[model samples]
Target: MINLAARDILHGWGKFLFTGIGLGLLIGTTLTMAGVFRGMVDDAQVLIDNSGADLWVVQQGTLGPYAEPSSIRDDVWRGIAGLPGVAETGNAAYLTIQMAHAGRESRVMIVGMDVDRPGRPGAPGYLTAGRPILHGHYEAIADERTGLQLGERVRLRRHEYTVVGLTRRMVSSSGDPMIFVSLKDAQEIQFLKDNDALVNERARTAANPAFNRPGVPGLLEAAQASSGQSRNVNAVLVRLEPGANPDAVAGEIQRWKRLTAYTREQMEDILVAKLIATSAKQIGMFLIILAVVTAAIIAFIIYTMTMAKLREIAVLKLIGAQNRTIAMMILQQALSLGLLGFLVGRASAGLWGPAFPKYVLLLPGDAIGGFMVVMVISALASVVAIRAALAIDPAEAIGG
Candidate 1:
């Protein structure tokens, strides 16, 4: 028996090739969406890994430093350092802002860390180009993604910080590049407002009845003075001793300090599951929509191709061809298109994944799963064509 599907495809090779190319582009977009979601999860993991801390201490009843707004006394780390099984502790604050350097602007996460200690939490894990922050007040270690160079000054929140070091792949949970600065400066930049906002707040405080009363002497002046300084840290990072129990130390801090303590696992859950919930949902929806659209396109192509071969199909039936043979012919063509499309889509995703502004991690498993789904979709889409072909009357070939 001759291969009917192969013969038909060769007769219309151009049409089949062009149709598969269109489907391939659609499949490529779907693959890219999966890569984007994978990248987000990896970004969260990277954030946890780079901190180099076993436990995160934050404000009571709140998620901190990434998922939610948390405030704790800047000096709380001193007490935490004395806890049993605690090897090292560092205070950190985070603030995201759009910063300009040499007429170019990029959004970045400004990390305030303890520059007094080497290998401190929140410090960059590796330096790609320059050294770490040396001076306390205005020195910075910027991620290479931020487009900042060594010896460049980036004016941020009333202070100009000189970039002295460069790090690679140091990004926040939101995929913004991080710029490391001294704890004091980060506190001020994170908590302090602009000059005008400060003036307004001070004026409001001075006009309050409790502060501006005639019986109160210098109360308003003192309140105004206190408002200008930043003494709050968002979170404290703790490193454990070689044989220490993180849960026990965290419990001690919670019981005595009245602050929240989260182990590394808990922090990862917050960042990946809670913080990125909405974004994940959005990507899921896009994937679903793309799947539906791709299925529709495939169905249309297969149905049209089968309908166009009605005369040939009628002649085959009149010559005593079995229904299985005609059905197999259509199914084979559909699978061929799917296979070609998948190869093109996989190649496209690999070539363009790195060009994305944020990370796009295309894992091997995802690619394999995607190919399986595409093939299944192709088989299912061929159902309409198969059924239509089987319905052709053998008499039609002789009647004309």
Candidate 2:
């Protein structure tokens, strides 16, 4: 009537507990890997949702600002604005640039938006502090992750702007903080050149026979002026009327405007499936390898633990203990070990997730899935130890 499993575990508590801890750490890494993948997908979805745009109009035959380099004339929005089912359209320019703040430079996605309309497409979904960009000149808004406070001036390219507002969770697809500036300033920073380069370019153009022809009175001057200006934006964000079909509006723009247009769903596919697919696969492979390693360690530990109790197992078999009872003892012990490991892993992942630079969204469902997987693997691993224990001859107990 003795509880053989409990007695054995208690007798070697050190080995059992330490072995469980080692396995638990591996399980924790596996869980964290899955969480990292989920976080990336969630961040991509949030980016699309916060844009408040049903359709994204980009350059012809190319992905938008998130996936590739897309350049559309700044005035392209006017054409899409006049389309059917379009409730409103906003001109948005996105350029990734390094800006200096507090004597350190951090990579940021500079978003150019219209300050006149506070609730337009491409504006921050919500603010944590200060106000939205109310002026179009030298004021700026930044994500809280950038560590920039209100009234602080940051230098970008050739101009300096003061941070007048702060928002939360506003990040680029790469997890870089987003800094918002006026369309004019962003354009300048996007295509600005040094004074020396500008003067040299002017001299080169004026020396051209075609531009300096006598019949063309203002040809050289006009060419130089045009070359120094940037009149293009990355993409246009469009918000359709309520219940308007985004697919139809996108089709219309692609056909008439000869440009590529993507609905929210399409853009999400590009970001999640195309942009981050390889990284996701890499994480998945790591999870698989970790699971294998965890299972191997558990099997070896359990087999070794069971082997140490050979005398007890032999005596139990000789004293009328059924084979099922011995097998169940091993199975129960394996499952218990798995449960302990899972708890440790879940707690560890939660503790370290926030400290990660990128967003680490650990969902409850994923944690539950991880627990199930560990238990199954542990059960499979116990098979080897169970078989080995069951093979021990009952006669061994009597030293025969």
Candidate 3:
């Protein structure tokens, strides 16, 4: 018996190949969408893991630094430091801002970390080039993705910082490159005001009767000085003693210190479930829609291919070709198309994943999962065309 599937593909290979390529591009996009979600989750986990913190202490009842704006006094870590099971504590300030570098503006997460220790909670896990920040003021460490070279100066607010170190995979949950600066500088940048604004504020305060009373000699100057300084940090990163439970330590901080404490698990939940939840759901919806579209396209192609072989199909039926044979022919064609599409998709996603601005982590397991999904969808979609072909009677072959 002739190989009907092979014959059909060979006879109309152009249409079949082009249709497969189109479907492949769609499938590629679908796979990329899934990869985008995976990349987001990976980035969140990496952000948490790289922090090397057992717990995060934020302002009371608020998600800090990532999900929302959280400000706690820089000294709050002192209280948390004295808590039991706390191995070490660090004050980390995270502020997302647009900074100008080489005449282009890029949004970066400015992470303020203590430079005295190399293994501090918020320090970079590893460096791609150069070393960690050693000096306190005017020095910076940037992720490689920022495209800033060592010794490059980037201006943040009114201050400029020299890029002293470089790191890899150091990113915010949104995949923005993280730039490390000293806590003091971060605080200043966070609250830095323009000279005109400062002058106007001083004038306004000096005019206030309560602050400008004759008995208050230096009250106005003192007030202005205090206003010029920032003593706040976004969140405190805490490391628990080995063998100590993070949840328990977090509870002590919350109860005694009157601050919100989150364990590693809790922080992950907040980042994934709350921070990027809507985006994940949106991608999921797009994946579903794309899958449906891919299936429809495959079904249409297979149906059209089968229809072109109407005379052959009718003759095969007339010559005692079993219904199973016809069905298998359609099924195999569908599967082949799906296989072709998947190959093209995987290649396309691989080629384009790195070009994306955000992290597009394409894992082997995810690729395997995508392949299975494509096969299943192709099989299901073939049902429509299979039914249509099976319904055609062999008598149609002999019709006028």
Candidate 4:
């Protein structure tokens, strides 16, 4: 017996090929969605890796920077540095804002670091181009995604910043490009109030009899001066001494300083499990919907193909073809379509992955799993077509 499925496919290759391409495009979109979720998880991991800190210290009773608002005095790091098992500590502030560069605005995560020294907890591990911040103020190192070039000027509130260095892959957990600036600048930008708010606050303070008390020399002036400066930071990043236990160091800080300390593992859990939990759920729902739609499409295509071959199937039955032969032919055709579509989908995903704004990490394991799912869906979808083919009566071929 001739191989009927191959002959049928070759005879109607034009329409079959077009249908396969359309299905492949849908599969490609599904694969890309999976990559997007993987990319989000990877971005969180990268943010953790690049911080180069073993512990994070934040305001007491708070989840810390990414999960919620956390504010502690910048000077807390000084006390933390002297704690046992602590080798080095840095005051870091994190705030996300839309920044303008060369007429385009992009969202960026501003990181305040102690550029005064190398190998500090929050400093970028390395620079791809130019040099790290050399000035005590008004200089920055930006992630390349910000479209900033060395010496380019970027404005933050009333001050202007010059991009001094560019770093690669230093992004926030949400994939926002990071701009690393001096601790002072970040404090001023994030903590300081605007001029209008400041004037009102000063006026309010002066009117209060508490700060403007009679016989209290210089009381009003001191109160006004303190309100103008920013002394708070989002968190303190800590690097432990070699062989130092992270939990032990964290415990020491929590015990004496009355602040919250998180080990690297704890912070990672907050970022991936809590901070992005909603986003992960939304992506997972999309994956399920896409999978169901793909199965439906395969069933429709295979059933339609079987219906169109009813006359030929009747002729085969009249010539003594077994039911098993007919069912296998349909199953083979369905699997062939699935294989063709998967190869196209994989190629399409690879081609368009980099063009996405956020990272798109296509892991090999996901592809393998997807292929297995596709084959299973194909086999299941062929059942409908096989049932229709097996029901055709041989007498239909010899009807009057």
Looking at model 1, residue 190 earns an lDDT score of 78
Off by over 4 Å in 4: none
Model 1 TM-score on a 0 to 1 scale: 0.93
Give all candidates' CA lDDT scores. 0.91, 0.88, 0.89, 0.91
Q: TM-scores for all candidates?
A: 0.93, 0.95, 0.97, 0.96
Sort order, TM-score high to low: 3, 4, 2, 1
What is the C-alpha lDDT profile of model 1 across 117-173, one tens digit per residue?
789777888898878777789999999888888988889878998989998888999
Q: Residue 391 CA error for candidate 2 (Å)?
A: 0.8
- Model 2 — which ten-residue stretch has the worst lDDT? 1-10
Residue 58 lDDT, candidate 2, scale 0-100: 94
lDDT, model 1, position 289: 98
* Residue pairs that clash (backbone atoms under 3 angstroms), model 4: none
Q: What lDDT, from 0 to 1, does candidate 2 have?
A: 0.88
Candidate 4 lDDT over residue span 175-286, tens digit each: 9999999999998888788889999999999999999999999999999989889788889999998999999888888999999999989998999998888999999999
Best-fitting candidate, scored by TM-score: 3
Tell me the spans in candidate 2 whose CA falls farther than 4 Å from its real position: 100-105
